[model samples]
Target: MTVEALLIWLIVGAVAGWLAGQIVKGHGFGLAGNIVVGIVGAFLAGWLLPGLGLGLSGIVGSIIYAALGAIILLLLIGLIKRA
Candidate 1:
């Protein structure tokens, strides 16, 4: 991917991660952790969303998708930890 694309992905990831942390409550993993969560969430969304017929266009949509995926990821992690 081009540097510009990579940069955009990182930005989107950061934003999504931060938002997810806020929504999930007590799940904020600082900056680097948040970035990781965001990136992974994006990948998860990339796979899961399309299968569900969810299509998001542009930056805002991407952020929303990533945040939703991150929230799901956090919830799953919480469940695993509790189990």
Candidate 2:
């Protein structure tokens, strides 16, 4: 991917991660960690959503999808940590 695409991904990841952290509560992972979480969340959503017959469009949609995935990721992490 081009630099522009990479930048967009990072931006999306940051925003999505922040959103997920807020939604999940007490899960702020800082900037870099948030970006990683968001990117992975985006990938997770990209894989899971399609199979579930959900489709989102545009940058906002991407953020929402990624945030959903990030929330799931955070919840799973929380469970793992508790176990």
Candidate 3:
């Protein structure tokens, strides 16, 4: 990917992760952690959501999709930790 695209992805991931952290209390990984969660969540969403026929257009939609995926990731982590 181009440097510009990569930068955009990082910014989007950071935003989505931070938002997910706020929505899912006690699951935040702070700055670096959140960035990782968001990037991984983006990859997860890119794989899972498309299979479900969920198509999001533009940057805003991408962030929303990433946030939803990150939220799911956090929920699963919470479950695993409790189990």
Judging by lDDT against the true structure, name the best candidate. 2
Report the CA-based lDDT of candidate 2 relative to the real structure: 0.92
Q: Tell me, what's the RMSD of every candidate?
A: 1.2, 1.1, 1.4
Cα miss at 48, model 2 (Å)?
1.2
TM-score of 2: 0.93
**Over the stretch 4-53, how does candidate 1's per-residue lDDT look in tens digits?**
99999888889889988988875577888788889889888888889999
lDDT: the better of candidates 2 and 3: 2
Candidate 1 lDDT at 20 equals 89
Query: What lDDT tens digits, residue by residue, belong to model 3 across residues 1-83?
Result: 99999999889899989988989875567788888889888888888899999999899999999998898888889899999
- Estimate the lDDT of model 1: 0.88
Off by over 4 Å in 1: none
Question: What would the per-residue lDDT of candidate 2 be over residues 1-83, giving only the tens digit for each residue?
Answer: 99999999999999999999988976668999899999999998998889999899999999999999999888899899999
The TM-score measured for candidate 1 stands at 0.90
CA lDDT of 61 in candidate 2?
Answer: 96
